[model samples]
Target: MTIAGSDSGGGAGIQADLKTFSALGCYGASVITALTAQNTRTVTMIEPASPAMIAAQMAAVFDDLDIRAVKLGMLGDARAIATVAEGLRGRDLPLVLDPVMVAKSGDTLLPDDAIATLRDLLLPRATLLTPNLPEAARLLDTTPATTEAQMAEQGAALRALGPRAVLMKGGHAAGPVCTDLLVTAAGITRLTAPRLPTRNTHGTGCTLSAAIAAGLARGLDLPEAVALAHGYLQRAIAAADGLRVGSGHGPVHHFHAVWPHV
Candidate 1:
């Protein structure tokens, strides 16, 4: 299940999560925290769901269905973070938290006032926390990382923030290869793939975290899940052009290997 915002463009948020789950052979469910008016080019507007409504959606899901894992993304405000955290209270399920901050087009997704609430309330509940460079930086209240070593360092720091494992994405770093560092209670594991030259990278983060959550639902370990997600994302991005979506940063081809689109 994915607890996130709705992306009208079907390129990110809950749309991306559901697509990733389907591509990986997992049944998906969702509780939308907000609604977004967006395209591949930009996120034009975001309207957050009320706290009561957010709580209701989650209740509707938790009361039924055998949900194995949940992925979170684009929580719009403090109330949303609190409501979600409260709804999931006491459930011992795998929670994959994607600290969505800004859109690929540079639009803010999370309200500035909610950052602290996310850390204090939601961070502890995540089984795995996935954050790109800037999100990790904001969570740490520091500068964005620019190197692999720095990413590893930040990954460790983020792991300390309560997630059983933290995957720090190094896509923002300069290099031929994009490395994602996963820091866990045991240690850190680096998942690397050759960076593809593509403009269609819009929903990469949401897709990866959703894939990881699906892997968890499928009984993979944290490292194993992240590795599988890394491989999947690499293929999706490499085949993104096949989707033939919007003109800028189009959606990745989620089922590039299986159930290929005609």
Candidate 2:
């Protein structure tokens, strides 16, 4: 299940999550916490769902389907975060929490005050937290990371926030290679891939976390799931330019290697 916002562009948020789940052979379900009138270029407007509506959607899923894992994306505000936390409290499902704060087009996806609620109410319940450089920085109230060493430090700090592990994404890093750091109680490991040159990276974070959720649903361990998801994201970025969806930043091809590339 993916608890996220809706992207009318179908590039990121719940749209990307469902595509990723299907590509990875996992059945997908969703609870939309907000709705955005957005395209690949920009988010024109955002309207949050009522807490009651969000709860209803979650109950509609948990009450029926035997969901294996959950991927959380853009919760619009504090009430939405509280609603989801309350609905998911005490459930032991593997949760891939992608701290989605802003969009690629520089639009705010999550409201400011809700950050505190996410930290207090949602972080502890997460099995794994995936935050990019900026999101990690904002969550910790520090400067964003720009190097592998810095990312490792940030990953460790994020793990201390109560998630079993934290995956600090390095897409914002300046380099020929992008490195993602996974910090767990077990240890820190680096996953690197040559950077693909493309502006069509609109939905990468959402896709990667959703892929991880799909992998967990299929019974892979966290490390294995993350590794596979990383590989998938790389190919999706590589194939992104071929897709001419929008005028500005386009979306990565979630189905690029659906038959298996790595």
Top-scoring candidate (lDDT): 2
Please provide, for model 1 over 1-262, each residue's C-alpha lDDT reduced to its tens digit, 9 standing for 90 to 100: 9999998998889999999999999999999999999998988888889999999988898899789999999999999999999999999999999999999999999877899999999898899999999999999999999987898898888878888888999988887888888888887788888988888998999999999999999999888888899989998998898888998779888889874773
Q: Give the TM-score of candidate 2.
A: 0.97
My TM-score estimates for the predictions, one after another, are 0.97, 0.97
Instruction: Give lDDT tens digits, candidate 2, residues 6-107.
Output: 999999999999999999999999999988999988999999999999999999999999999999999988999999999998798999999999999998
RMSD of each: 1.1, 2.0
| Residue 197 of model 1, lDDT score | 86
**At residue 251, what lDDT does model 1 achieve?**
88
Residue 245 displacement in candidate 1 (angstroms): 0.9
